[model samples]
Target: MDYRLEQDLLGDKNIEVSSYSGINTARALENFDLGGKTVNLHLIKEIALIKKAAAMTNKKLKFLQEDKADAIIKASEEVIDGKFDNEFKVSAFQGGAGTSTNMNVNEVIANRAIELLGGAKGEYDLVHPLNHVNMSQSTNDVYPSALRIAAIRLIRKLSTSLSSLQEALQIKENDFADIIKLGRTQLMDALPMTAGQGFGAYAKAIERDRWRIYKVEERLRQINLGGTAIGTGLNATNRYVFMMTDIIQDLTGLGIARSDYPMDITQNCDIFVETSGLLKSCSVNLLKISNDLRLLNSGPRGGFGEIILPKMQAGSTIMPGKVNPVIPEMVAQVSLRVISNDTAITMASSMGQLELNAFVPLIAECLLESLELLDRSVVLFKEKCIDDLLMDKDRCLENLENSLVSATALVPYIGYDKASLVSKKALSSGKTIREILLEEQILPIETIDKILSPNELIRTHISGK
Candidate 1:
């Protein structure tokens, strides 16, 4: 355990000689130890990108010497490549609006740059964290901009996963196109529908989610990267301020733009809230679809049992030969967790003060976690559950015939009053609607068969009379 002394405004502390983090990061490690949950690696990598862009911009502006800029650029690239990931030890729940995380990145980049420049790790004189690596940047601008970058990258991934999930549903929809089943509303029988129609509806909902997530990436593209401190580019030159976004865009290969009102972008965080709300909407659809699948796959013996999910694992400790709808259940839980993360993100976004939001780290944590969780869960759901789904055609027909739901189709010919009478009679006598209708001679056998035919009953479009 050899160490080197690193000094900050507070005092001096011994940093490990081999560590690539400086005094600020060391202080942050000691100050904010909330549950040992480190900042997201995506955020760290994006911030490193920002630092790299800033160094290049500074060198172009002649603010940093070429040698120092090159060292910092190389170090920042290493950080972006995750070579120094273990050095970012700050908590994700830290205060100062992610200043701790920002400084942690700065220190790691600076120390790594120092080592690259043939200087000792703690040699700030050669490559100072703030003066060299964080030139023309502040946590206020850098942190939020980096967060947007990380979030947009992750949002793209989520959109892709949603697309895959939608495709899986569409495949199932086609496979089950002719398998007629009972449609339930309010936990009661409603009408007859093909299992394909049900899966088609799920696919449509997920398609909307995919588009929503894809469109929201546009909102995140406008950033306030040069609005250092309080959206007033005080220490940063006008040239640097104007050039930052273009440099960052080129470096990260994202279609990012500078904010029209950097102050507004710096002060407000509602974009994140809006993004989280969209995620919650997607989660709502996922929860609904998962519940529907669970119901469709409910029981081979006792439940609706209209369809069977892939047998993932044993359902119970004591029940032999029992399998559970584990993938849908996992999808349901992930959706609920994403919903909860949305709530936290909403709260954290709304709690920002006049000029800066100190709660962005929490927002980043929850939002990134939600995105990753949904992406993985959706892929698992599609591969493990939706793709291998099996329909119990007999069970579907049995449930459809056992219920009085088909009485609604009788209304077109027999009128509503007659339909209700038929339903009531079928319920009371424990007979099916078709049986009761035929017994009472409500309609001719030819007409009755025409009305209750699966093709005639499940017609999605109406024919003009």
Candidate 2:
């Protein structure tokens, strides 16, 4: 472990780590000490974008040779098939503008390609990392392209998770449609509504989120690979950019396009800001829904008493037989974390001072972490919260029957003044409105039924008509 001796033997020389060293997926992984974080193979979504950009330029590089291209293509296929998952050890916080990540992938692909060609270890002479594997590409272009692909992949998973949550809400809407309860405003009972109506609103808000994320996906597909090294296309051929784009398109099946303005591409990380903002918007929606569910399921015996959530575990160690609304509570907690990550993304995007966004590494880190956490939250909500929701039908009817909300319907028949008088009396005397009206004898039973049946009131409640 002597520093000078080790440096002489294995350091500055870049002393050929066996082509097999990099290829020995295990050895590369262990020696790199990359922590447990790998370049998520799911990030192929970003890799695919890079490949397409490179193919578009028709660059005719070593990596594009029939055999080498075929090899990289096959390795990429393995990534899609989820083969090289753990090898993506490049940390999101790495220095050199993701040069370490770019080289990690280049080296891994080169070694794997060499092995595929029946070559031995240290065989970069046959297939060099820079000379063959990364031909016609710089870390600047490839790294950003891959980051975009990774972000796109994360967004897609998030969209699916949100969609599942939306569908669960929709199903609950129909299931709870007939269970009428006292609706609240500012946490105070204000009117009558069906449990179905509340759940339906949640579903609709999530549906809106799915569409907002789709717009971000659209923006992610625009990459700046051909504009290497400050977007000047320096050291790159015009044909290289177009051909690389075409090849990657065939490989990944993602409809990626070259940046119309390459110079702007390097100078700005606006897409990351915009996409992250959209995700934050979705997080806001999720927080709102989580807060609502927590309130709705607040108490089985003490709180709102409107609906029952499926109990997942004991609410407390000291309290016996306690079933808390743990699912919604967990989601609310996760939402706070997601919001915090959004703040990090905002700061990272803003700190981009010059032609290149030095903070991109941090931006990618926060965004990917948020997406993964959101995915877990959405899945937990769909499975533990929404799917198992049940309405306390009798309780709902009981609360609705006693609420003064029914007074609103009386306005048209009895006038607001009389209705207010009746409401105040009923509130004070602890008498049902039905009993008060009957005692007052101002309206007949048939008139009362026509004006204020729960079903009719709920119809009015939903339609506002």
Candidate 3:
């Protein structure tokens, strides 16, 4: 309960003596108390990194003394390494165009750096938050730049998870390659295909998403770090602007660049919108693939029953013995959340005003949340679902035999009108297409068997023969 008094433009506020944050963080804590959520730790960490880069650049430019700059650098690195996670308490949905959150980082770094210098916590003469920690940077520039860095880091995780998921699906594709099943359109049996082919289609979708996310890293790399208040680079020297960005790149090893137009980077968040759109695209694909798996894994005895999903848990207490496709169902729900987050991000990005997007904290929250959800969901799905995914070969073949879609294979051999009539008759008679053809002596018994074999159907679809 011990506290120290710290001052800002709004005047003095009491902050915890042991806490890393100062009066700005104190005011932020009071201002954003109505909400339950706090600023993201990922953002806090990135801001610390930006501060560390600024401290180094300022030291190199002789703008700051070595002892103070070195102390600030060490303090900022500690935050980057997750030393003070509980210190940042500002809400993610705050006012001030992310200034509150930015200042919180400044205050925390300032106080921690003071401690590093063996000075009293509230002693600003040794290391001031605004004058020392946030030197040559503004919330408008630092928040956006740090957001981009966080996104790049998150995207890399998502991309790697997606790659693992894709590889798992590819393995299933090969494992199910010989298990022919009925393919459906509009929820009705339409044609014949191997379960491997179906899984391969999902693999391809994930592969494309991985490529899209990889490309987004490059777009996200360009930022407006030195573009002080409104992208004017005001108060920031040329050396600081140039070297700060390079130091950041060196620190993180990301291909980040200072934008030529800091104002554009300041006022517009369309890159986030575009990046969110890519996440939405991937989520949509996941939704489709997950729902497809759920459907294919529908029933052991009642539903389409074409395939069996891995049963991670018992489905219900009263159902006697039922196992659900819980993993795919969980993945589907996560995809829905990601898609909804994308909509929120798009809306928040569109509301940016004359100089800076005031909704950046929300943008960062939603976008990072989406990326985290995708990365976690895709990885869990790969490990719990796709890795042990097994196709019900006998069930797949049985469903194919029962479906009148084999009539589709006969379309080229017997003509569309005749195939339609044959399909209708087979459905009405509850007979297989081969049986009907044999009963009618159409093309003789041997030819009918050759035409109706699963391999022949796949080949015919491929070659149109």
lDDT (Cα, tens digit) per residue for candidate 3, span 232-264: 988998888889988998999999898988899
Candidate 1 weakest ten by summed lDDT: 456-465
| Residue pairs clashing, model 3 | none
Candidate 2 per-residue C-alpha lDDT over 1-465 given as tens digits, one digit per residue, 9 for 90 to 100? 211111212333233444222432333444556576654444533553354334333325543556666665455455456565555665556555665566666655666667788885446766565666566677777767777777776788889988998999999999988778888899876878888899899899999988888768888877777787788888777777776666666655777778888778676777877887777878888888878777766667776666688879888889998888888888888888878888888887888776787777777777787788888889988998888878888777877777888888888888999999999999999997888898989788888867677777777342222
Q: Which tens-of-lDDT digit does each residue in 243-356 have in candidate 1?
A: 877898888789999987888888888999999999999999999999988887877798989888888888999998888888888989999999999999989988999888
Say which prediction, candidate 2 or candidate 3, comes out ahead on TM-score: 3
Query: Model 2: residues >4 Å from true position, as ranges?
Result: 1-41, 44-86, 114-124, 441-446, 461-465
Q: State each candidate's clash count.
A: 0, 33, 0
lDDT of 3 at 334: 90
Candidate RMSDs in Å, in order, are: 1.6, 4.4, 1.6
Question: TM-score, each model?
Answer: 0.97, 0.84, 0.96
Model 3's alpha-carbon lDDT is 0.88
The runs of at least 3 residues in candidate 1 whose Cα sits more than 4 Å from the true structure, single-residue gaps closed, are 460-465
For model 1, state the Cα shift of residue 304 in Å: 1.3
